[model samples]
Target: MKRALILAALVLGLGGAGWWYASQRDATGAEADPPTVAVTRGTVERTVLASGVIEAGTLVPVGARVSGQIETLAVELGQKVKAGDLVAVIDSLDQQNEVLKARADLAQIEAQQASNAASIREAELALDRTRQLNRTDLASTQALEAAEATLAVRQAEARALAAQRDRAQVALASAELALERTRITAPVGGTVVAIVTDEGETLNASAETPTIVKIADLERMVVKAEISEADVIRVKPGQTATLTLLGDPSTAFEATLRFVEPAPPGIAQNDAAETTEAVFFNGLLDVENPDGLLRIGMTVQVSILLERASDVLTVPSLVVSRGDGGRSTVRVWDPASRTATEREVRTGIDNAVTVEIVEGLAEGELVVAARDSDTASAAVTMRGRRSVFGF
Candidate 1:
C-alpha cells in the first residue's frame, strides 16, 4: 500500500507541472502583440521666437530751454497731457523781474530818444536864427561861424544818443523773449513719463548738462526686435507679427513690419576668420496702443511669421529617422499585419515637435513612433532566422 501511495504522489506532481507550463505559454502569447499608435496627418506651423522690448514708435524728449528755480510743477509723472499744455513753471519771479527791467530799460531809452530829438530841433532853430542874424549884419562873421560849429556838435551828440537808445531797445526785446521761454510747455500730446526736478529746484541754463524730463506718446508704439543672423533672411518689411507683453501675458498686440536695418548699426565684421555667424538686423513693427496699456521700456516676446502652410501633410518628429547614408526614413505600420515597414521620405520645414512631409507620405496612414521591446525582440528573431536560412 505504501508503494502505491508514493507512485500516486509523483503522478500528481507531474500533472501540476504541466498545468503551470500551459498557463505560462498562454501569458506569453497574450504579450506578443505589438504596441500601436494612432497616426494623425495635419497641418503644422513653424514659428521663430525672439525676445524684445515694447517701445513707443515716436518718443519725444522734453527738456528745459531756460534754467531757473522750479517754482511750480503742473504735471506729475505718468500724467496725460495735450500739446501746448503747460508742463512746469520755473521761478517766474526772476524771469518776470527780468521782463520788467527790460521794459523799464526800453521806456528809459525811448525817453532818451525823445530828448535827443528835441535837442536836434532846438539846435536846428538856433542855427537858423544865427544864420538870419549874420545875414542882417547884426552879428560878426566869427559869431556866425561859431553858431554853425555849435549846431554841428549838438547834432552829432544827438545822433550818438539816438544810436545808444536803439541798442538798448534791441536788448530789451531779447530779454523779453528769454523771459517768455521760462514757462516749460509740452511739445506733443502725450503722457509725462518722468520728471527730473521738483518744485524749488534750481536749474542752470548755461550749464553744459541739461535737466531733462521724459515724455512719450502712448497712443502708438513700435517694437524694435533683433532677429538672429540665421533667421533674419526670412524676415522682411510689411510682414505681419504678434507681440506678447511680458507684463501682461494675456494681451497680444498685432503689428506690421515697417523696416529692417540693411546693415547692423555699430558692428564690426571679421573677414579673416571662417565663421558661420553673421550679424543680426533690426526690425521695426508699428503697433497701435489705443488703450494706452503699453508703456515705454516694457519687455515683450515677438513671433515673426516667416512662412505658413495650410492643410499640408505632416508627421511626428520622432517617427522620422535619419539614416547613415543621409536618407530620411519613417516606419509605416501595417494595421492588419501588425508590422512596421520602413519607407524613405523627404521632409521640409521641420519644427520642434512636428515635421512637414513633402513626399513619400500620405494622409490617414499609420506611422510607427516607437516599438515595444517584445516586438523588437520578435523582429530580431525573424531577421536571425532569415539570415541563418539565407532567405
Candidate 2:
C-alpha cells in the first residue's frame, strides 16, 4: 500500500507540471500580437527644421564719416526714426571752420577769374588799337606784337583761374558734405536698436567710420536660419516657412523663404582645412512685423516646408518600415485572422510625425506601430524594419 501511494503522488505531480506549462504557453500566445494603429487619410508634409535669429529686413548702422566728439545724441535706444532724421551731432566747430575756408578759397578763385577776364578784355582792346595804328603807320610792329602777347597772357591766366575755380568748387562741396556728416542722420526708417557711441565720446573716424547707432526696420523682419549642411540642398527660396520666437513658442509667424546663402556665414574668415566642425548654411526668410513684436537678436525656431500633400493616406512614420531597393513596408493587421501580414507601400513626403502613403495601403486599415516585448519574434521583426530614417 505504501508503494502504490507514492506512485500515485508522483503521477499527480506530473499532471500539475503539465497544466502549468500549458497555461504559460497559452498566455504567451495571447500576447504575441503586436500593438497597432489605424492608417487614415490625412495631410502630411516634409519639412526641414532649423534654428534662426530675428533680423531686420533693412538694417543700417549710422556712423560718422568725419572724426569728432559726439556733441549731442538726438535719438535714444528704442526710439523710432524716419529716413534722414537727425540721429546725433558731432562737434561742428572744426567742420564749420573748414567750411568757411573752403568757401573763402572758392570766392577768391572766382574774384581772380573776374579780374583775369577784365585784363583779357583790356588787352584785346589794346591789341586792336595797336593793329589799327600800325596799319596807319602810327605804331610799330613791335607794339602790336607786345599787345598780342599781353592778350594771350591774360587769356592763359583766365584759363588757369577757371581751373582753380573748379578745384575750389569741389573743395567747397566736400567741406560742406563733411559738415553735414557731423550731424548724423538715419539712413533708413526704423527704430534705434543700438547706441554704439555716446555723447562726449570722441570718435576717431580717420581709419574707419565709427558707428553711432543701429537702425532696423521692425515693420518687416528677416530671419537668418542656420541650416545644417545635410539639409541645405533640400531648402530653397520661395518655400513656405514658419517661425516661432523662443520667448513665445505658441505664436507662430508666417514667413517665406528669401534665399539660402551659397556658403556658411564667416566661412571666408575660417580656414577650411583646419576647421573640423559641422558646417551650417544660412537661409533667410522674410516676415512682416507690423506690431513690432519681433525684435532683433531674438532666438527663433524655424520649419521650412519642403513638400506637402493634402487629403492623402497617412500613417505614423514609425509604423512604416523601409526595405531594400528603397521599398517601404508596413504590417497590416487582419481582425478576422487575428494576425498581421507585411504589406508593401509606396510612400510620399514624411514630416517625421506622419508619412504619406501613396499606394499599397487603404484607409481604416490597422498597421502595427510597435510590438509587445512578450513576443520576441514580433519585437525582432519590428526592430529590423525601423532602421529606415526619415523619408
Candidate 3:
C-alpha cells in the first residue's frame, strides 16, 4: 500500500505528505468527493483600512460684534436657523440713549438757527432803514455802514450753526447703527450646534468678537480620516469608501473620498534617534446625512476602496503561489486526464478572498486549491473545494 501511495503522489506532482494521505481516501471513494473548483467570472475589491471622526463639513460660529450684556437669546442649542435670523439681543439701553442724545443735540442746533434767522431779518431791516435815512441826509454814513456790517455778521453766524446741525445728523446715524449691532443675527443657514453663552452673560467685543452660539451644516457630514503613511499613497480623490460608527457596529454608510491633505496637520519637533512614532496622512470623505443619524465628533471605522475589477475570471487567493522574480503559479486540475498540471498565470487586483486572473486561464476550468486532508485512497477529494486553502 505504501509503495502504491508513493506512485500516486509522483503521478499527481503533489509533494506534501498530507496530500499523499488524501489520495488514499480518494482511491476508494473517488465518486463521492473532490477538492476542485471551476474558474468563474466574479468581482474582486481591495480596500485600505482607516479610522476617523465624523464632523460637519461647514461650521459657523454666531458671535456678538458689540460689547454688551445679553438680554434675550432667541435660539437654543440644536435649533435650525436661516441667514439673517435674530439669534440674540444684547442690552441696548446705552445704545438707545446715545441715539437720543445725538437727536437732542441736533434739535438744539436747529433751535439756535431759528433764533439766528430772526435776528438776521431784523438786522437787514435796520440796514435798509439806515440807507434810506442817509439818502435823505437824516442818518450818518458811518451808521449806514455799521448796519451793513451787522447784517453780514448775522449771516455768518447762521452759516456756522447750520454746519453744527449737519455734524449732529451724522452722529445720530452712527448711534443708530451701534444700536442695531446689539441685536445679534445669524450670518449663515444651519443648525445651532452649541450655545456658548447664557442669558445675561457679559460679552466684550472690544478686543475680539465673542461667540454666542455655534452653528453647523449637518445635512452633509464629513470624516477627516487618518490613513497610515504606508497606505496613504493608494488613497486618492473620488475613490469609494464606507464607514461604520463605533457606537453602532451593524450600520454602515457610503461616502466619497473628497480630498487627501497635502501635508500632515502639524509635525512635532523631536531629536530622538530611535523614535518610533507612526506617521499618518489626513483624508476627507463626505456622506449624506438627511436623516441626521450621523453627528459631529462621532468615531467611525473607514475602508477606502483602492482597486476593483468586475466580471473577471478569478480563483481563491490561496491557490495562487508567489515565486521568485514576481511570478505566480497555480495548479490546474484536468478532469479528462485525471491529473494536476502546473500553470503560470498573470494576475490583476486581488483581495483577501479571491484573485483576479488576467491571463493564462479560461472560464469553467477546474483549479486546484490544496491537497485533501484524508489519506485513505487515490481519490483524494477529501474536503469541500470552496473551503480548501492552497499553500
Candidate 4:
C-alpha cells in the first residue's frame, strides 16, 4: 500500500511540472505581440547620386608640328599663358640650315633666269636682223632659218628658267615655315594643364605619336556627368543641375544641361564588363569658374531634379507591405483602442524611405510594422477565453 501511494504521488508531481512548463511557454509568447510606430509628417526629397570628375569645357592638347630635339621649355605645368605665347623652342639649327640652302638655291636660279632673259632678247634681235637681210637678198636662207630657230630655243629656255625660279621660291617659303614651327606656341589663352615633353627630350613627330603639351581654358568649365540609360530619358538640354565638388561639400554650383550625347564615345573598347551592360549617356553642365576654383580632372557630384510633388500624404515604407496578386497593403491603427487593422492601400512615387500613399490611409494615422506572431496569438486566445468564460 505504501509503494502504491508513493508511485501515485510521483505521477501527480510529474503531471503538475509538465503543466507549469507549458504555461510558462504560453506566457512568454503572449508578452511579445504589440506592434509599434510613431506617426509624423515632413518633407522628403528624391535624388540620384553619381560620382564624376571635373573637366574643362575647352581642352586643347598642344603638339610639336616638327620632329626635333627640345631646346628649352618656356613654361611648366599649371602656368598661365595667353594665345600666341611661345611656350617652348626647339633646336632651330637644322631648320635654319635648310632655309639657307633653299634661299641660296633660289638666288642661283634667279641669276640664271636673268642671264636666260638677256640671251633670249639678243637672239630675237639677231633673228629680226637676219630676216631683214634675207628680204634684201644679203643673208643666206639657211642663216635666216638658223637665227629663227635659235630665237625659239632661247625663249623656251627663258620660260623654263622662270619656272625653276618660282619652284625655288616655294621651297624657301616652306623651309621658313618649318623653321617657325620649331618654336611651339599656345593656340588659345589658357593655363598649361600638362607639359609632356621636357627640355632636351627628343620628340619624334613623324613616328605617329605627336602631342607635347596640354592647354585648357579654365575660365569656364563643364561637368560631363554620366547618366544611366534609365534616367537619361527624363533629362533634357536646358534642365537645371546642381554640381557639388567632392572635397568641398558645403557649396554647390548651379548649371544648365548644355548637351546630351546620343551615343557613348569609345564604347566598343571598354574592357569593364560590369559596366558594359549599363549604357551611359553623357550630359553636359556649363558652369563659370570665375574664381578659378575648378581644375581639370577634379571629381564632382551632380544632382538633376526630375520631378517634384508637394503636400502629399505619405507613410513609412516598412508599414506598406506587399500582398498577394501584386496588391499593396498596410496595417492601420485604431485611434480609439490603438489596435492594428490590415488595410489595402495605393502607393506612388516611393523614394525608398517613405512612400506616397494615394488612398486608404490619412495623414497623422499610425500604422503597424509587423507584430510578433506568438504574442498576437496569445492575445487573441486571452480575449477569446475572457469572452467565453464571462470573466
CA RMSD of each candidate after superposition = 9.6, 8.8, 8.7, 8.0
Stretches off by above 4 angstroms in model 4 are 1-48, 264-266, 270-276, 308-391
Q: Among these predicted structures, which one has the highest lDDT?
A: 3
For candidate 1, give the lDDT of residue 201.
83
**Tens-digit per-residue lDDT, 1-391, candidate 4:** 9967977776675556545445545455532224556445555456555556678988898888888898889998889999999988989898999999999999999898888889988998999999999999999999999998998998898889889989999999999998999999999989988878788998887867577789998989988888887888888887777788878988998877889887765555654424546677778888889999888888899887665456777777777888789699877777577467888888776778887777887777777766335644554455354332132
lDDT of 1: 0.75
**Candidate 4 Cα lDDT to native:** 0.79
Could you tell me every candidate's TM-score relative to the true structure? 0.68, 0.78, 0.72, 0.70
Better of 1 and 3 by TM-score: 3
| Per-prediction tally of clashes | 0, 0, 14, 1
Name the better of 1 and 4 by lDDT.
4
Candidate 1 lDDT by residue in tens digits, 1-391: 9967976776675456545444434455642333444445667767666777778766777767677887778888888888899877877676678778878877887787787778778877877887888899988788878778877887787787778778777877777777877788888888888777777888787865355576788888988888877878778888888899876878798888898887665444543432456556778888899988777788788888776666778877877887787688888888778667888998886776888888987787888766224644554454345332232
Mark the 10 consecutive residues where model 1 has the least summed lDDT.
382-391
Error of 1 at 38 (Å): 6.8
Give the better candidate number (3 or 4) by TM-score: 3
Give candidate 1's TM-score.
Answer: 0.68
Q: What shift in Å separates residue 277 of candidate 1 from its native position after superposition?
A: 11
- The residue-by-residue lDDT of candidate 3 on 1-391, one tens digit each, is 9967866766465446445554545557554234788899999999999999998979988898888999999998889999999999999999999999999999999999999999999999999999999999999999999999999999999999989999999999999999999999999899999999999999999999999999999999999999988999888899999999898989989999999987666543434322266777789999999999999999999999888899999999888888999898888888888787889999998886899999989999898777332344433443323322232
For model 3, give the 10-residue run with minimal summed lDDT: 382-391
